[model samples]
Target: MTAPMISFEFFPPKTAEGLAKLRETRKQLALLNPKFFSVTFGAGGSTRDRTLETVLEIQSEGHEAAPHISGVSSSGEEIQGLLETYRNKGINRLVVLRGDLPSGEVSAGDFHYANELVSFIRQTTGDWFHIEVAAYPEFHPEARSPSADLMHFKNKIDAGANTAITQYFYNPDAYFRFMDQCQSAGINVPIVPGVMPIYNITQLARFSDVCGADIPRWLRLRLQDYGDDLASLRAFGLDVVTELCQKLLAGGAPGLHFYTLNQAGIISTIASHLNLQGD
Candidate 1:
């Protein structure tokens, strides 16, 4: 079998110190030779400038950069301008999303959904970008039903997204079942599994709650038992996540997209454990 493609996601840091640390982290991850390094757009386009700056710098470092763009709080003119800027800067990849609504925001601006954003990009930039949209193996939290969530995902794929990256999920069964559903629905685009290397149960619980990813009851209890013993927790988390990746790949996942949380230690270890080094 061919080696699976791998990618890493990062958020733009707000502080000078944080940015410096992220730069170092990227340097370490770069050795893994990911397909690209993606920088996230904050909720409602909050980190627009920082994201742009970070991606441009990554490009300068000679690595492919995929900057994310969220459509919920942005206007057509604004989105158009950003696309033009990235095209000019030679950034040819993007992760599109229906961004979180800014606290107390009433309108969804020009594009209300991620499918709209994908469609807009195609209209404005044609085939200039390789677009990736969000997918939810466990169903989106706000989705009214499973069928509705599948319909929404199909809409994004139909709107011109080249591929998708799923929300981080611990259960490989959930991913395989979602893939089966996508196949039945005739959605053929590559849908990469997102992996989150867990280090802290509390933080993982908070994220899982918001994103609708299920942490199996047994796994949660085991993690909780680790309590303040970070060393034991991390070791166990590493084993769990590494096994998860193995199962997904063995089951024919297209690739893996890691939610690195801007730290290299655990991610690096996981990649090594998976033998994800480039050929």
Candidate 2:
């Protein structure tokens, strides 16, 4: 069987100690031969410099890097400069998003939506970069309605996204249904499943609440039952997430993109469970 093309998402490290730890984590995960290592961009470009440095470092280490970009607060010139930098460094992929407005900030900047940024990238870069946009199988929290969310997703593809990576989901049916809706809407690009390993129950709960990713009552209760038993929590979480990955692949999902949270053990464990760590 052909090996699956896997990728990992990481945020820019803020300190030298954090960067060192990330490098160590990257070294371990590199064994899986990931397609690319994507670094997250912060809201309002807060981590712009750190993101650039991290991506450049990844490239220096002989791995493909996809830097996230947001046009929500950047001008044409600013985005163009980023394009040039990525091109110079031979970075060919980008995870594009209309990032959240920082707290207490109002202006949506020069661009309002991800589709506009997709259009701008197409116009400026002219196919030089492979753009990846975000998709929400469970619907975006800010979307007015389900159909509206799907329409906006299709709009991003219509503008110029090469493919999409969905928000991490545990319910395989949700992804399948989302894909069916996309197909009906005439979107033919790959919609890779985003996988987030359940590492910290509290952190996961907070994130899921904000992003609208349901944790199912049963799973929530299970985690809550674990209480302070982190070892048991992690093992159970791994099994659950691994089972989710298996179902996604078996059901014909294109690929898996792990939101690694800069940790190697959990992702590596999940990878081993899927038999993806084998040569």
Candidate 3:
């Protein structure tokens, strides 16, 4: 059997302690030999410097670092400058996004959606970078409709996105249906499923709400049965994610991208189930 291609997403750290934790997380996950790793950008490019530093560190440690960029946070020139900085630092991949609006605020300006960011990256970099765009199996909260959301996705691909990494979902059917729609809409690029093992039910629920990923009643009931048993909860979460990965692989997913949440144990457990191990 062919080995599955795996990648991880991490957020930039904000303090000395957080940076140490981030580095430790990187070190642990790096043992799995991921295809690449991504660092998320904060709202309005707030974590710009930290994101760059983390990417550079990952590259220094012999890993591909794909930095996230938000079109809404930057003008063309500013975006160009950021790309140039990454290029100089030997980074050649980006996760282009139309990031969430800041709290208690409205619009950010310049670019409103991901397609514009894709277009801008292609125009500015000329195919020197591998660009990844976000996809929604359950639909984005701001999207007009499922069809409209897919139309926007197709626009991003047409603009030069090489792949679409979907938001995490509990149901494999949702991903399968989304892929069918993507194919019908002429998106032939790889659409990797993003998997987030539910560590904390409440926190995951909040995030799912923001990303429009539905938590099935069955899953909620299962977690509720575990109550305050941390060890049992962790085991159950790993098993659930592992089962999800197996189903996706069986259904022909190209690869898996983990939202690691700056931790490695859960991802390691899932990878073990997938028959992938650190060398």
C-alpha lDDT score of every prediction, in listed order: 0.94, 0.92, 0.88
Off by over 4 Å in 3: 277-279
Cα deviation in Å at residue 33, candidate 3?
A: 1.1
User: Which residues of candidate 2, in runs, are more than 4 Å off?
Assistant: 277-279
Q: Report the lDDT tens digits of candidate 2 across residue range 78-157.
A: 98898999998899999999998888889888889999999999998898999999999999999999999999999999
- Ranking of predictions according to TM-score: 1, 2, 3
TM-score of 3: 0.96
The C-alpha TM-scores of every prediction are 0.98, 0.98, 0.96
- Measured by TM-score, the strongest candidate is 1
Model 2's TM-score against the true structure? 0.98
Better of 2 and 3 by lDDT: 2
RMSD (CA, angstroms), candidate 2: 1.2
Poorest stretch of ten by lDDT in candidate 1: 270-279
Write candidate 3's Cα lDDT for 1-279 as tens digits.
566678999998888998899899888888788889999998888889999989999899899999999977578889989999988887999999998766765767689888998888888889899999999999998889888988988999999999989999999999999999998888899999999988978788899888889889999888878888978988898888899999998999888999988888888877877786422
Scored by lDDT, the top model is 1
